[model samples]
Target chain A: MPAALHALKDFSDIHINLVGNQALIEAELASKSFDKNRLSITHAEQVVDMDELPSKALRNKRQSSMRLAVNLVKDDVAQACVSAGNTGALMAISKFVLKTIPGIDRPAICTSMPTMKGHVHVLDLGANVGSEGESLAQFAVMGSVLAKAIDGNPKPRIGLLNIGEEEIKGHQRIKDANSLLKLIDINYIGYVEGDDIYKGNVDVVSCDGFDGNIALKASEGVAKMIGFYLKAAFNRNLFTKFIGLLSYPVLKAFKEKVDPRRYNGASFLGLRKIVIKSHGGADAFSFFHAIAEARLEVQKNVPALIAQEVATLLTPQVIEATHNEI
Target chain B: MPAALHALKDFSDIHINLVGNQALIEAELASKSFDKNRLSITHAEQVVDMDELPSKALRNKRQSSMRLAVNLVKDDVAQACVSAGNTGALMAISKFVLKTIPGIDRPAICTSMPTMKGHVHVLDLGANVGSEGESLAQFAVMGSVLAKAIDGNPKPRIGLLNIGEEEIKGHQRIKDANSLLKLIDINYIGYVEGDDIYKGNVDVVSCDGFDGNIALKASEGVAKMIGFYLKAAFNRNLFTKFIGLLSYPVLKAFKEKVDPRRYNGASFLGLRKIVIKSHGGADAFSFFHAIAEARLEVQKNVPALIAQEVATLLTPQVIEATHNEI
Candidate 1:
């Protein structure tokens, strides 16, 4: 509630519809000052628990805050929806309410990750486990569109994530997806290895949810491990500790540069409406960044652009040619 | 050659047979001081190119240095074989010459990675891509034996790498592997996410080559990215540059703590003989560490232990039970 209120204060052009128990929200917002005209509350009778199954939530929690937020988007009362609720439930409710774009088979979880030069968008961070060639191709297109919408890159270099750069490497589905992507109008680069994700050469990387999820989580693990090592190194002895104090400002700047809060929102692309999933443990600052991400997606009209791109790129002939090649 | 000569000087109990051209080996070793009796040379006329396909190398390079080195291991002239040549060719030729332990489907690439407590062993780093339930179970057993041999942990905690820890979360093959692992005699700790690889709670992490390869490479990418960011942060201004100098010793200590050279060798587990693959671009120190890893494996007789474990754990009843459950 505070994050939304803070965002409302920061972004003058945007309005927020906070969906939850109205009385509880009002109590939380009692002390915070904001433009009441720009901030409204939509009372939701229920709330989705973090561990609740997606199917059960979809079946039973129709009036849940998550569901109401999606309803607001569907009814045009809201241009976008941002949630820090259960990922599975949010995905289920949003997919049910907003539906997918005409040609997209499934919505992918896309987020930007820090890289050498800037950052690159990666998709299917655990939406589906074993994606086929056609579904992977669709992820490529969606990721490309989102990259274009967000980064303003007219031709984002799209790379298929694989174990090796050679055409002969990886699974058959990757090969099929490679052929399909090559036929698309987008700037489809050839295969990229795992290290290429941080190289910043490729603007977008597409892979199955299994691989994407593993890569993202593995990167997180490495970051945490490094942090653990860095702390231990700084506290080794009196001299090291004193040096750590002198290096504090430089370390602070580095931390700010790679802060995860700045990249808080993960958009569910290929949907009819913009839906952003913030990290569940986000604080007010991080949540505000997610809201800001939602505002950007809404302003860019990402879904419409994706719809147009997918409709053109996934024509009958392209699908047929891809199948034949596979 | 210098690394090998250095190892000969350090480890008084071991001798080395340099397998490349005699003239070239002698020329490189001319200035190096080592015990003459501890070093010998075997001349080979051919060399395996780094980019050569594994199949082509196996078929055409019969007298290559890689083949001769493996032959020395097969003939018991050397207790272990370590090569800094092409990974694929080394694996292929080693598998051809040494074959596999009975009941083991394939030889897996196993290596130790830096972790929170100390380090953990991860297997199938690129030996086979799409491993089935049976193969994954075999990998778990082989990894378990290798961990025991190296870490001296009688019953090492074994984890199957998955996208999530929930039984219902990954692909069907993972579920099948889970059931099979549960039935195995080793300390099966169930599914672990990518971050668990560095947590150090699990002694060995087993996965199909694709996931393992991606996880490892993704880790490398993150490490490189952090290093890049750290350098940028220090070079921002004169004051920060001064601080970087003050923190140099601390940073150097941290680097040594997580140095890649300290964990250089990747053992080819499940082979009848010990084979270690050093990084193709390894420096003298890194290559020496690889040699040290091979020496450890030889001292522990890892292959014999793995073969004995497989023979005991993979009995007919166990296979039948696994097949029925799958």
Candidate 2:
């Protein structure tokens, strides 16, 4: 509640509809000073637990805070919605309330990753586990559109994530998707290995949710492991600890440069409405970034842009040709 | 050649047969001091290029250095073989020359990755692209045996890499493999996500070649990205540069703790004979580590151990039941 109020104070142009227990939200907000006109509370009767199954939440919790937030978007009461709730439940509720955009088979979870040059957007972090070649092509198109809409890259270079760069490598589905992407109107670059994600040469990378989830989690694992090792190395002895203290400025600079909080929002692309899924454990600073991301998507009108692009590119002939080629 | 000679100098018990042009080997070795009794040269009429197709190398390059090295192992002239050549060609040649162990479906590329605790062995790095449930079960068995033989862990916790920890998540093949692994005699833990790879909770992780390759390369990518950011941060200004200089010893300690060169070799497990593949761009130090890895495998008799375990656990009823369940 404090994070949301903090975000409300920072973004002067936007209004927030905090959906939960009105009394509890009022109690939390009593000490904080903010513009009363810029914030509203919608009383929701239920809340989704972090570990609750998506199906059970969807069926049982019709008045959930997550559901009410998505309903606000659906009813045009809000331009966008950002949640730091259970990912599965949020995805289920958002998909159910907002539905998918025209010509998109499903919504993909897309997020920006820090890269050497700047940052790159990757999709299908863990939405649908085993997507077909056509679904992969859809992910590529959606990722490309989101990249262009958010980054203002007129022609963002798109790459298919694969085991190898060789055309002969990877599964048959990947090869089929590669063929389909080449036929599409988007700027589809050839295959890219996992290492290429951080090189920043490609603006967007698309893959099955299974592979994408693994890649993202593996990257997180490595980052955390490195952090752990750095701490251990610095705390080895008094001399090293003194050196670490002296080097604090440089380390701080590096941490700020690659801070995950700065890149907190993950857009649910291919949906009819703009929805951002913040990291579940986000603090006020990180949650503020997620709200900023939502405001950006609202300004850009990302869903309308994606709908326009998909209508123009996904012709029946092109889809048939890709399926036939596979 | 120098790296090989350096390794020969370090390990007094191992003999190395320099398989290539004998005249060129002698020219490279003339300036280096090494014991004469520990080194021999075998002239090969052909060489495998870095980009050469594995099939072409196997079909045409009968007298290639890679082939000769594997042949020496097959003939018992050498206990184990190590090569810093093309991965595909090396796997193809090694499998062709040594063949698969009984009850082992295919050979997997297995390597150790640095973790928070120490390191964990991960298999199917890039040997096969799309593996079935049975093949994944086979990989688990082989990886478990290699971990036990090398790490001396009586019961290594084996994890199957998947998108989620839920029983119903991930591809059918993965779920099928999970069921089969539970029926096997190894220490079969439930599904683990990608971040678990570096958590040091599991001793071995088994996945298909495609997912494994992506996870490994993504890890390399993150490490390199972090290193690049650290360099950039330290070089930002004159004051930071001075601090970086003062912190050199601490930084070096962290780098050595997670040095890729220290974890150079990838074993071709399930092969009839032990084969180690070094990174193609390896320097003398890194290549020496690869040689040391091969020596360790030879000492542990990895292949024979894998064969024995596979024979004991992979009963016909278990295989048939897994296939039927899938």
> Candidate 1 on A62-165: residue-level lDDT in tens?
99999999999999999999999988888888888999999888898999999988999999888888888898999999999888888999899999989851
Q: lDDT tens digits, residues B62-147, model 1?
A: 99999999999999999999998988889899999999999998999999999988989898888888888888889999989888
**What proportion of the true contacts does each candidate reproduce?**
0.66, 0.74
* TM-score, A chain, model 2: 0.97
Compute DockQ for each candidate against the true complex. 0.66, 0.70
Residue-by-residue lDDT tens digits, candidate 2, B1-326:
77788888788889988899999888988888888898999999999998888898899999999999999999999999999998999889999999999998899999999999989999899888778888888999988998898888999999999976242388888888999999888899889899999999999999999999999999999999999999999999999999888888888999998999999999999999999999999998999999999999999988888888888899898898877776
TM-score against truth, every candidate: 0.98, 0.98
Give the per-residue Cα lDDT of candidate 1 at B57: 91
| Global local distance difference test of model 2 | 0.89
For candidate 2, report its TM-score: 0.98
Give stretches of model 2 more than 4 Å off. Answer: A165-168, B165-168, B324-326
